[model samples]
Target: MMVKVDRLSYNFGPHWVLKDISFSLDKGEFLFLTGHSGAGKTTLLRLLYGALPVNRGRAQVAGYELNKLKKRQIPQLRRKVGVVFQDFKILPRRTVFDNVAMALEVRGMPRPHLERRVRAIVRAMGLETKSYSICERLSGGEQQRVAIARSMVANPELILADEPTGNLDFDLTMHLMDIFKQFHTYGTSVIMATHSREVLDCVPEARILHLQDGRIVTDSEPGLEEDVQ
Candidate 1:
């Protein structure tokens, strides 16, 4: 299994954000997380990526145990999992090339190889012409593409995207989703959180997990059952 969760729950201080949840994802599977804004979609993604602490439940991602994960071990886990946040988290002053190359740079990848990899991914994202352009000056969709290129450059085993097409128009959204689908076809496991039905239809074979009030109302996929606390 690429991912496994059991009785997961989360909160901010006293208020609960995610109730008990359970799910398992297999290698090469593409899963869609469907929920309203406050339905804890992003929160669940965060936990999976090791951005948030997993205190109440068990989660195994990319062979690492999330609840027992340590600070130093976070980087190790991230090496196998790429993430595209709802918010574009690229450096505002950095060029698109720099932004994309940063992923490989941290891995101690050689500059020559890193440049080639970054350029390839930037081209794949249709940002080759803007490689040297600063990110802040780009349009919202362009910035989102940069974020995606950065996430995909390393070719991680798993990709976790949170509403990746939220800021894009129908055409552009479809384009980017096609790129995601291409990666999934290459055996990269994907768990994308999306609200657009169009985006969901982009991948007819993907399983859907629908959330409501931080609980799973439906997990339309085998191997995972809804566990609402």
Candidate 2:
């Protein structure tokens, strides 16, 4: 399994944010986590990426036991997982190339190799012309593309995207989603948190995991119903 969660629950201070969440994702599978705001979609994604600890139940991602993952092992785990946040998270002072090359640079990748990889991903994202442009000067859609390119430049085995298309228009959202689909087709497991009906409609064959009050109420595929407690 690429991801596994059993009887998982999380709390912030005294408030329970997730309750007995359980599910599993396989390699190359695309999963859509759907729920209203505060339904714990972000929390769940964080847990998978090791941004938060797992204390209540078992949670495994990319073969690492999240509950037992050590601090030193986090960087290794992160190198294999890409995350796209709702807030672009690109450094305003950095150029598009720099933002995307940061991850490779941290890995000590040589300049020639790093540049090639970054340029490839930038071109793939349709931001070839903006490779040297400052990130802050780009439009919302362009910034979002830069963010996606940054997340994907290192070729992570799994991707966790939180409302990646929330700020994009119809055409841009579809375009970005198609890029994600290409990644999925290449065998990367993807878990995206989205509330957009259009996004759901676009990937009808993808697994749908619906959360309500932090609990998974449904785990089904398109045209098929499965009740998950």
Candidate 3:
């Protein structure tokens, strides 16, 4: 399994954000997290990627025991699990190539290999011409693509994305969806948090986990009628 959660829960001070969530994702499987804002989708993704410490319960992501994971071990876990933030955390001052290449550089990859790998993913994202352009000058959609490219450049075993296509237009959203599907075809496990119906339709094979108040409600409610936005 690429990810496993058993009775997982989290809290923010006195307010509980997640309540006894449980699910497992097999290796090479693609899963979608659908929920309205504040449904705890972002918080759940944060716990899986080690951004937030597991406040309660158990979670194993890309082979790391998250609840027991040490601070020093976070970098190791991250190398095996790629994350695309909802905020697009790429450096604004850095060029597109620099932002994407940073992932491999942190791993001490050789210059020749890093350049080839970064360029390939950049081209896939349709940012080949902007590879040398500063990210601050790019539009929101372009910056979002930069974040996606950076997350995939390292070829991690699992990818966790938070609304990757939120800022893109219909045509660009479909284009980016194709790129995601291509990577899934290569056997990379993916757990994407999204509210777009078009995005869900694009990956009909993916298992949908609808989160309502941090609980998986799809099993009890087979009707699955919440708009998905």
TM-scores for every candidate against the unseen true structure: 0.94, 0.94, 0.95
- Ranking the candidates on lDDT from highest down gives 1, 3, 2
After superposition, the stretches of candidate 1 with alpha carbons farther than 4 Å from their true spots are 221-229
TM-score of 1: 0.94
The RMSD of every model to the true structure, in order and in angstroms, is: 3.2, 2.2, 1.9
Between prediction 1 and prediction 2, the one with superior lDDT is: 1
Tens-place lDDT digits, model 3, residues 45-118: 99999989986899999889998899999999999988888764899999999999999999999999999999
Could you give me the TM-score of model 3 versus the true structure? 0.95
Worst 10 residues of 1 by lDDT: 220-229
| Cα error of candidate 3 at position 155, Å | 0.7
Give the per-residue lDDT of model 1 (tens digit) for 124-228.
888889999999999999999999998899999999999898888888898999999999999999999987778887887899998898898898853353432
Candidate 2 backbone overlaps, count: 0
User: Which candidate achieves the best TM-score against the true structure?
Assistant: 3
For model 1, what is the C-alpha lDDT against the true structure? Answer: 0.90
